[model samples]
Target chain A: MSAVLTKDIVKTFADVNAVDGISLAVPDGEFMVLLGPSGCGKTTFLRIICGLERQTTGDILIGGTVVNDIPPRARGVAMMFQSYGLYPHYKIRDNIAFPLRTQRVARAEIENKVEWASNLLGIGHLLDRRPRQLSGGERQRVALARALVREPTVLLLDEPLSNLDAKLRASARNEIKQFQQRVGTTTIYVTHDQVEAMGMGDRIAVIDHGRVRQVGTPTAIYDDPADRFVATFVGTPPMNLVAWNGGHLGFRPENFLPRELIDDSAVTEFSFRVDRSEYLGSERIVYGVLEGLESVQEITAKLPPAHVDQESIRPGEWHAFAVRNSALCYFDKDGKRAIRH
Target chain B: MPRPLAAAIREVSFYSAVLFFVVIAAFPFYWMVITAFKTNSDLYTLTNIPFWFNEAPTLAHIKYLFTQTLFARWLLNSLIIGVCVVAITLVTALPAGYSLARMTGRSGETLGIGIFMTYLVPPTLLFLPLSRVISMLGLQDSMWSLVLVYPTFTIPFCTWLLMGFFKAVPREIEEAAVVDGCSILGAFIKMVLPVSVPAILTVVIFTFTLTLQEFVYALTFISSSAQKTITLGVATDLVRGDIYFWGELMAGALIAAIPVAIAYNLFLDRFIAGITGGAVK
Candidate 1:
């Protein structure tokens, strides 16, 4: 019942449109991630839904009620800020109990709910300490505990993992995903990191320039991007777009492989001259320029360490590379996806 | 000089500079204490080494101050005025400061500077005009006039200070509170105020001390002996036109000054932090 729906949400600051006409729906218990580069209006859109920022013209509905006029607290939503924003003077128990206390929840019930939320987040032992005393990861969990204590209909998180170091980020990501699944509250997470979106989101909405380019599962966003922007933005070393046929031919780095390795009968061939290669512990990314194209377009091939031996690919040498016909994506002159014949 | 000797000379000069300033600062208190306890004859004698008691120290002047003068009354008057002014400053400045800090764009900064400009106006120049207002209110000889006047300066300065302190507090904290179900004012009270203890403490101390030390308006507004504040009473009551009661005056000053001195020392670091406002952590 706690689904969130927004209709044509737009927020303008002065002459600039920070969020331009974003309409989205989050079904109950779904983990939706708004993914974009920095300054891409993803965060602004999330804030609009949370009621922290009012959209210039839009209707926001939470649980079938149009909540455009409702304030954040009345809308039954909780947001975790980028900085965690834990009250420095309050003990961890009091921090978790704050939202409940504001609503005049009875003292005994407040204590019970605080204990439940803290224990759920595995932070029961740290409840007596203040926020300044905790580590970054511990503080993040405390923020999560405080947000969850209210049992709000929708949970909004704004780049909560961006503050954590890389080693802790993966584990924290797992904990959050598992916690959401267990709790089953509709969640909207905003992040600029595509890897996080791919690993964690039930669905990812790729946005740019205050507009949503596409919204789909991570696989759909990755393998079947709707346009050139989504194709280039979602992957690392991004989807390689080479000039072809008055438009561009796009394929993922992993899909563009040595002709010897791609065993598929229907595949497109290229004379890829190796410019350089990077040996990443698990895979080697080979950077090269393709021959027979009028313009020298740079592209990369991701080779698994087991499949490609070291010293086999060297600079100044040419190799035959192929992409499976199905994996090849065609874009018209306007950069929109065109049907492949 | 040899390397070790050169280092020794540098250390000696540094300690000497520190000791020189300490003595310069401590000498006034030393003179005040000795004069307060010294016998009048011993204090006045030209032949006796004035640094120490030439005669036995006695409580005669201290007794005279208590019995012959309204020293205790003046202390009580100061306390009442200090408390009242501090309360008014807090009630007015805390909200004024919070609003100015939260206000967006160039206008808040401009308005804050406008408010602070009032604090820079000299009290000596202000007291003349203020006395006219005092007489119009029929508060000519009442200490309540001081309670009303001290905040004219205290509120402006304290508001400017508190504004800076509140601005340094992360906006996310208040925003988080609003999302957690508190109204904006509720967020300020529960979240903003608790974390702002050092700045609030700074404001309290600054307002209290300023009220304690103020003399101009206190002297202008109150003419009767019974209504006089400590600063005005101590400076005027212990002096006869041609002769000065150095012992009684120093005793009054010593008693009045000790608390303020101790307070400054106690909260000096936090006071500096509050004034800077950006270095809350």
Candidate 2:
């Protein structure tokens, strides 16, 4: 059975459709991410599945049972908020034990569960401390412990790492994924950061303007974006898109290289002026205007530093770059990817 | 050398002004205590001998107030009314405020504003109409009238204050509680209320003090001498027709003011915090 299935979920606020009739099924033990920008209704969708919000017209099934009308407590799901909502008045131990206490578990069982969750999160020593007394990372761990202590059927995390600093966000993302894997819980994470969605999710659902644009494994979405929005939103320095007569050509900066690396018969070669080059340690990014094209159109190519260094390339100079035909992506005028021979 | 001299002069002038203001405000209270102990002749003379106590200080007025008058009974009546008003204000205002904070959309916002507007309407206008209502209810000339009327003013203001307090709680904290198996009401009681103690204390102190010192409604609604509160009882009975019992009156005012002053001082930090916490985002 599917761990969770949301069928034709529709939520409307006044005249605006916040979630416009979407559907998806999350397999058990898979980490699925709803990736979108703010105001895209990804968080609203997560809330609806968690039962914190009600869908205007839809059905939700969790663990093979319909839970459309179930209250949040009876939904058998736990949510971790982005703000790390630790109860300020309670010590960490009590905060983690809140879910068990609410279920009226025996006192000894509550203590044991709280202790086990705390120790797993490496917060055993901080159990006696209040949330205000702990650091940002520590408070996040407490929130995670609280959510995990219940051992719910599904775990919902809403932008849980957005509040952390950049350095901490990377480490926290890895730790959260590792923890989810160890617990083997079916997880649904919502985030606006596509990098986070790509790095953490087993499959990503790209949403925009309250509709799902594409849903696929990270590699599929990266290499074969269904539309222009997914192409531009998924990658860093995103895919370079240029208008063609009847279609569009899409390629990544790294795919473009010095002409010598390409087999002459199997490559498409283009000449461009080297406007500038940025040394990014492992590779150099070359930015230039395509030769014989409109001045407004600029192309970026990522090449190994040795090639650019050997050629003595500098700004305001011209160079020839090429790519294998297999590496190029074609999108029709409607922004949907078109098959290329 | 010139700058140093100018700075020193500025510092001295500032200190002098502060001292002058403190003395000016405190002199009347000081004179009241001095006169309360003086013989009736000393009071009539109105001498400017401010620093010295009466030549033959006596407690005759204090003795008279306790023994011959219903001063003690009136004091008891005021305490009972104040405590009851405080309790009622808290019970009604806390939940109303939480609802406004949590449930406010456009309509709730309009209703909250409307409730606050009622609070801002001057009490002078309200008391006249309220007296008729009080009499119709057969509460006039009784402590019950004051108890009922006090909450009308106090409840609106306290609810407004607590709405701000409740809004300051992060929504995520409450949502976390809900996910932890708490019902909405359970989350409020278990999570929201405990963090809001400082704001609640401010509301309690403010409602109690305002009810204790209110004069117009109490004086207008309650006509019977037997049922008078401390404010009306002290102001009316202590002073006779064309003869102000200056010493006895001052003594009575000072005695009545002590409890509220002490309460304010004890919860001063919370009062400041609650009032200002709403001003921040």
**How does each model score on lDDT?**
0.91, 0.87
Fold similarity of candidate 2's chain A to the true chain A, as a TM-score: 0.95
* Top DockQ prediction, candidate number: 2
Candidate 2 chain A: worst-modelled 10 consecutive residues by lDDT:
A289-298
Task: Quote the lDDT for B56 in model 2.
Answer: 84
Scanning candidate 1 chain A in windows of ten residues, the lowest lDDT window is: A292-301
Worst 10 residues of 2 chain B by lDDT: B45-54
* C-alpha positional error of residue B189 in candidate 1 after TM-score superposition, expressed in Å: 0.9
DockQ of each: 0.79, 0.87
Each model's total of backbone clashes: 0, 0
Q: A1-341 in candidate 1: lDDT tens per residue?
A: 54999899889999889999998999999999999999999999988888888999988999999999888889899999999999998999999999999899999999999999999999999999999999999999999999999899999999999999999999999999999999998999999999889989999999999998999999999999999999999998888888888888899999989899988899999999998999999899999888876432468889998989767787899998999999989898898998883
Q: Provide the global lDDT of candidate 2 against the true structure.
A: 0.87
